[model samples]
Target: MITSKLMRPLTTGGVLASTVLFASGCKSMIVFDPKGPIGEQQRDLIYFTMLLCLIILVPVLLIAAWIVWRYRDRKNNRAPYQPVWSHSTKLEIVWWGIPIVIIVVLAVVTARYTYALDPAKPIESDKKPVTIQVTSLDWKWLFQYPEQGIATVNYLAIPERTPIKFELTSDGPMNGFWVPQLGGMIYTMSGMATTMYLQADEPGNYMGTGANFTGRDFAKMGFTAKALPQKDFDRWVADAKASGNALTEEGYQTLAKPGTTDRMTFASIPSGLFERIVHDYSMSRGAPPGYTLRAVTLSEEKKAEHTAHPKNGQLPPGNGAQKDAPDAQSLGQPDHRSGHMHLIHGK
Candidate 1:
């Protein structure tokens, strides 16, 4: 059955598979090559967890192979014959106790990091965070720089070492917002805005994409995240602001339609557009009796709400509001600088 014809095809297939594997292994792994603080911490945790598993895995595998070889049924096996030996208290304790101790250690370390690396937690930097609104569309991603007054489709830009507060929401199904080299994936769901704080420590070109399944054009839902120096970022913003393609209400409506398109930029965007989107999505035509949620949209308006207790005001960005969330002043503000309207929307 092992003829030359069959052998030829098998050899060719093996060579092709090896070549593909070698080529793939040569490619860059963005996660392992983290350029940001969050990404680096996450990568460390991954390596630690993997090594911890290997601590158990390696020894268990080696012992299993040794047991198989040493205890095999052979003509002259030298292994001890303890076939009826199963229950030893010392053995049970060693086997069960080792795994239990490892699990506890893992749980403790994991819990510590889970709290430390929270996506909402602010970075310890002197620079005021730049706020960017992110909207996941039918098959595209939209980014609006509220402070910079510019918007881009399938693209992102930020200054190095400055924290970026991304307010994420979706016009369609829940999509995963991920920039692998910056941090982990944060979800953008319809009817609500989710908060994520990410920063890049180095100037580099990075790729971003929707990490969840959407529809037929899901593969095309990728974007570029470029980290530039402060001066260069400002220059880019100024150039975009000088451009003529302003996105108005009508323009945004057209852009929101379900289709894939090339990179787009707008010199200006309608005010309160992001707040309106969150409000509209949350306020359905027929939401039951009274289902309303306070969204964390404008960090500026939220800032004014916190200056009531000036001590908390000193706290950076989102931290103060969260600490004093139960305070009446923290609920919503009377007006927003972006829209000059009530920050809170009623049913």
Candidate 2:
């Protein structure tokens, strides 16, 4: 009867655990389902560290359990008790020595992997790595293929078995760029560029997104990374060129607006666009051209009007001359007197 009762609860618990595991499907676990060389290395490191920790954890847990059971107070009090006992040199040495050795091993392994997995570190390959410039917008991702002379919004394409070097920056706010099945996450910051290297060993589609919580629409910031064979990738590039959609300065500004956007492809982009973007944010430039100038001018105008007409206390008329102001149809053209244009490079 006792054996049967014990078996009933054990069977029920085992069934429940299995059901839970079944409900959480393996497909949802991307870390364990890595598809790239970088991800495989990262997964291996995780497993190594976990195994090292378990080596210590299991014994400590077992010892605690044994001590609790054997030293439990009972009527017979057979367990040895020495109230005056202070310390054991052997026990101290064993505990301290083991942890010190584990720390030394962990430190060595960590340092080795840290340098080996650096995103900027080049991977050994016969074929040259492809470079892609990535810009994180308010709620979207923009990918510029400088070598291919094409760009895409919220979509990325790479050739399989080839290293891809990604240069990341943010046009809106700081965020994390991550493709969990391909590699580790890296931060994208304004006024700076970061690098990450990744390569897919097989042809497949992987999910990528901004891992950091940036803004209200952050949840919608995601993109698809498709890895294809060299031939297929070339075909896709040809198709993108046939699409005949060119990315211009004005179009980029519009796309950078804070909102969700669908995936899009561009046939061509202006030369040195990525370089200009970095230069605009660099310390030498100090601030984005036209951004601070307009704000300062507007503030000075408001202040001057208030000071000149203290009794009226009214703001000045817009831009001081309505006749010279460009019409709505000619909005992009520069206003001669103000020397200001709404669009960058008058695009």
Clashing pairs in 1: none
Query: Whole-model lDDT, candidate 2?
Result: 0.84
Candidate 1 residue-wise lDDT at 325: 40
* Model 2 deviation from native, Cα RMSD in Å: 9.0
Which stretches in model 1 have alpha-carbon errors above 4 Å? 1-27, 75-82, 285-347
Lowest lDDT sum, 10 consecutive residues, model 1, at 338-347
Residue 202 of model 2: what lDDT? 97
Question: For model 2, what is the alpha-carbon lDDT of residue 93?
Answer: 98
The local lDDT score (0 to 100) that residue 265 gets in candidate 1 is 90
TM-scores, all models, native as reference: 0.75, 0.76
Q: Alpha carbon lDDT of residue 104, candidate 2?
A: 85
